[model samples]
Target: MNPSITGFDYQRVTVAEDVALNVAVGGSGSPIVLLHGFPQTHLMWRHVAADLAADHTVICPDLRGYGASDKPAGTVPDAYAKRTMAADIVALARELGHDRFALAGHDRGALVAIRAGLDHPGAVTHLASLDVLPTLDMWDVLHGVTAAVGFHLFLMAQPPGLPEELIGAAPDAFFGHFLDIWTRDPEAIPAEVRAAYLRACREAVPSIVADYRASAGVDVAHDRADRAAGNQLRMPVTVLQQDWGAALGFDAAGIWRAWAPDLEHRTVSCGHFMAEEAPAETVKALRDLLAR
Candidate 1:
């Protein structure tokens, strides 16, 4: 953790079916839960979580199957469903006395947050997604060479055995590749922090792959059903994404508008890991969104 980011007391709690999560809690005001994306943990939000903790009761949790959280033994399809993971977040918040709270997630965590917003709109006061589209939109928008950039999405989405085996065989390389590639300023993440992330991913390979696999299969079904039922995130929503569309070929705002009616969307120059890559900008966007 960075010395500059302080004031949080870290604790471990179990939510939903004995799933243990490591959470950092601090500050006081409206509750705000932060979720980390793939190849990272609650540590990814170390900088941003500390900032939010200054005004809000910030709760940053390592999503189930990642970080210090318990990785329950299960198959890829069963272990990584966003529905199940979203339940863990809801249960965690409720356990911590927050029936309704603001929620934000980056990368994989963003996908789970989206599910939580869609499935439990009454419980999410506000929602912010960092650098990701809904799983369905992601698959729907992929094209020729543009999609190649996210090859891991397809590879990890494969059935249990092969994907897990390959990742497990070379865990450091697999996880380190993203850590190295996703940041414009790699030195921003200290050696200890980078090692921690790599270790977590190395140990939780099956569950991680299952998560992506579920996004490709069952998770998409859930999102489509929510859309078919005319469900839009009723809460004020904000999205910060790298300019994938401009760089690739789709409209980022246009796609998000389809799901959130009251959305404030922006494109930043940072890489996929916006929170760490652009903490000041991320903090500003978060403050502005929560204020609205």
Candidate 2:
């Protein structure tokens, strides 16, 4: 545990087969698990987690392939599927003795949270997604010049070796692009923290690519199946998005409502990285979700 970041007790725990996660736990109330996005670790929730910890027992862990978590080789295209990743969260919470808990995720993690709520509706008490739409909706909505904004999504969706090779060749520049572009305030992330995120991403290229590849493939199938089966998030869900649909050409809240029956969707001013860019609003949203 680094003393520089106070309030949380950090430890590494093996949560699955050959998967050990670096988890941070703090405060003393109901458990609220926070899942991080791509090119980022649990550290992305540093501010929000600390604030939530004051009233709720906050649990933040790097998703399977990112941060200090175990990066097992040969993760199949289906392995990075959101369903499997969501199961990991359930197992981690169970391992830590929480049978039911509030769940929140950002970006890639938000996709995982959606899967968890749908697959194991009984486990997740409340759900919060920051700055993302369902995988299928995201792909469906992309077209023309506006689609260029997420060029990396299409690039990283390619087959294993080539995409990994290209990204690995210049990892810092690749990861730094998002770190620099995704935030409304780049200064929100200190140099040391930014470098740390880039370094972690650089070392976990294969797993990271596999994660995105799943979204392009198996994850879409999973979402389609859920929709076919009339599955929706049973828990109360709160979504904070950047109003991409208005800027693009769809209804952001409308699309989210298709997946979540009980939804409270808000479009905020922050960039893609809302948790970091708008900590106070993010914290307040989480608190409201917890209350629901």
Candidate 3:
């Protein structure tokens, strides 16, 4: 059986036609939806969700084309676009009877949450992103040797068949590479959870690639349009990220401030998988965001 968030009730909430998200929801009070990043499932939020559940109604869901969620064919660019994924999240919350709620995400999920905050500002009461730049700025800052770190982004962004075939050929190596490197503390993700992440990624290669591919193309276009329109995340926004600025040669918080006016940008000392490696700090930051 698949590992799930402990103390949370699991269900399939229909977010869109032919796309129902696998969600684990718990606790009660004001609602907050937590989204997981790449190469993992809602289970990535297991630790943070449990703590947040003590007071807030925490909802954790596998984004479309991820985990146990419905994987509609990514036959078109828009299929896996962050916009569509964000819509799925908004609908998921509505189905669970929440019209407005605090939203947070890590990595890929952070991309979705950013899109949601831009597209559905009225519905996303508070917004927080963990360890990722917005799509447009992400592409803008990556240059020269610094871009080497994002090799997977370029590989997966290829037209279609080739990237899928290449990754599918060695799914474990491709996905496990991130799982191993991005994490600081191996024990943070016990063997079972690591196994679960690998299993899910191995099974969802095409959709996962599609998700990244969209980020390279349509997602960038959407972010560009939003920036051009002077659209920004109006809600209280908190960003928790490693101090990639010093190494990557860009002010991470400065870039985030361009998109979020009311922003609290923080740099974490932990690894990329901050939620897992430092759940206490993650929870504290989230609680602070909610309080604002």
Clashes (N, CA, C under 3 Å) per candidate: 0, 0, 0
- How well does candidate 2 match the true structure in TM-score terms? 0.97
TM-scores, all candidates, are 0.96, 0.97, 0.99
What would the per-residue lDDT of candidate 2 be over residues 1-292, giving only the tens digit for each residue?
3222367888877777888888898898999999999788888888998898887888898888888888877456666789988988998888888999999999999999999999899999999999889999999999999999989899889877899999999999999998888888988888878878888898899999889989999999999988899889988999999967798999999999998889999889978888888999999988888788
Where is the poorest 10-residue window by lDDT in model 3? Answer: 242-251
Per-residue C-alpha lDDT of model 3 across residues 118-170, encoded as one tens digit per residue: 99999999999999999999999999999999999999989889998998998
Quote model 3's TM-score: 0.99
What residue pairs clash in candidate 1, if any at all?
none
Q: Report the CA-based lDDT of candidate 2 relative to the real structure.
A: 0.88
lDDT of 2 at 177: 93
- List runs of model 2 lying over 4 Å from the truth: 1-4
The C-alpha local distance difference test score for the whole of candidate 1 amounts to 0.87
lDDT of each: 0.87, 0.88, 0.94
After superposition, the stretches of candidate 3 with alpha carbons farther than 4 Å from their true spots are none
